[model samples]
Target: MFKGLRETIRAYQERDPAARSGVEIFLLYPGVHATIYHKFAHFLYRHRLFFLARFVSQWSRFWTGIEIHPGATIGRRFVIDHGMGVVIGETAEIGDDVLLYQGVTLGGSGKEKGKRHPTIGNNVMIGSGARVLGSFKVGDNSRIAAGAVVVAEMPPNSTAVGVPAQIVKVAGERVNYTKELDQIHTPDPVSLEIQKLTECTRRLEKAMRELEEKRHEDI
Candidate 1:
């Protein structure tokens, strides 16, 4: 248990440059506190102590401003940065080394029965205000851009962006950029498509002008 706590603190220190001291992190970091609280809550939940589990979960949410259901399964090195307003639904399964920023939601679409939430694979980074709804697998090494609403499944090493998020980068050879926290560098498919349309319109206008000039000369 001490080892896990040490590892969690280390992860925060390594990932967040703003982290100054271990004492500060232990005393002030809500993400760290939430995770620790969840461990106990999860244990009680597993033991069929539903009321106690919920009470603990609610207490954690109130104290940390991060709502993580007791039924959610979280793996090692799960980092939630500036974790206020972050919600993890029951039945949601998060793998190791997953990084989540503020306002991220791993929620359901409707009133579903089993496996209603998302299953996030290892090394996945979900940016701030990103909504990953429904039962889908966010594959390992994938990055979900800030404010992206991902309703579909993402493959490994891909980058999802835009509303109803589209996979901008597929699982293949590309620039080896490892920093998943680079949310600003994510490609916008909507903007790219708009640019293409603008270029196409310009080319068509040029062709129309050329044809009109030729017709006048012929006359």
Candidate 2:
């Protein structure tokens, strides 16, 4: 447990430039506190102490503003940056080295019986305000852009952006998205579509002008 705590603190230091020291993170970081509470709660939950587990989780939520269900499975080095308003549902399973920003939700789409929440793969980065709903698998090394609403499976090494999130980059050279949070500079699919349409319209107009000139010459 001490090893795990050390690893978590190290991860925070590496990922967050603002993080000063391990002692400060242990003492002051809400995310670290939430994670510590979750470990204890999860242990109780696995031992069938459901009520106690829930109580602990609720207390953690009250104090940290991050609600993580005790039944949820979280792997090592899972960092939640600015963790306020982050929600991890009961059935959600998060893999190792995953990073989630503030206001991210791993929630269910409907009133399902089992496996309702999303399964996040290793090394995934979910940006702030992203909603990954339903029982989908967000693959390894994938990046979900800020404010994206993903309802489907994202392939490995991909980047998902926009509302009803679209896979913009897939299976390419790996980019360390967890270290970067520049949401404004990510690819805009809407702008690309508009540019394509404008180019097509220009081509059509040029073709029509040439046809008109040819007809006049024949006359």
On lDDT, the candidate that comes out on top is 2
User: 1-219 in candidate 1: lDDT tens per residue?
Assistant: 888888888878877879999888888999999999999999999999999999999999999999999999999877889999999999999998888999999999999899999999988889899999999999888889899999989888889998889997764843222344688778888898999999999999999999999999999
TM-score of each: 0.88, 0.94
Distance from true location, Cα of 18 in model 2, Å = 0.9
Worst 10 residues of 1 by lDDT: 171-180
User: What is candidate 2's lDDT per residue for 105-128, written digit by digit as tens?
Assistant: 999999988999999999899989
On a 0 to 100 scale, what is the lDDT of residue 144 in model 1? 91
Q: How many pairs of residues in model 1 come into backbone collision?
A: 0
What residue runs in model 1 are displaced by over 4 Å at the alpha carbon?
170-180, 201-219
lDDT of 2: 0.92
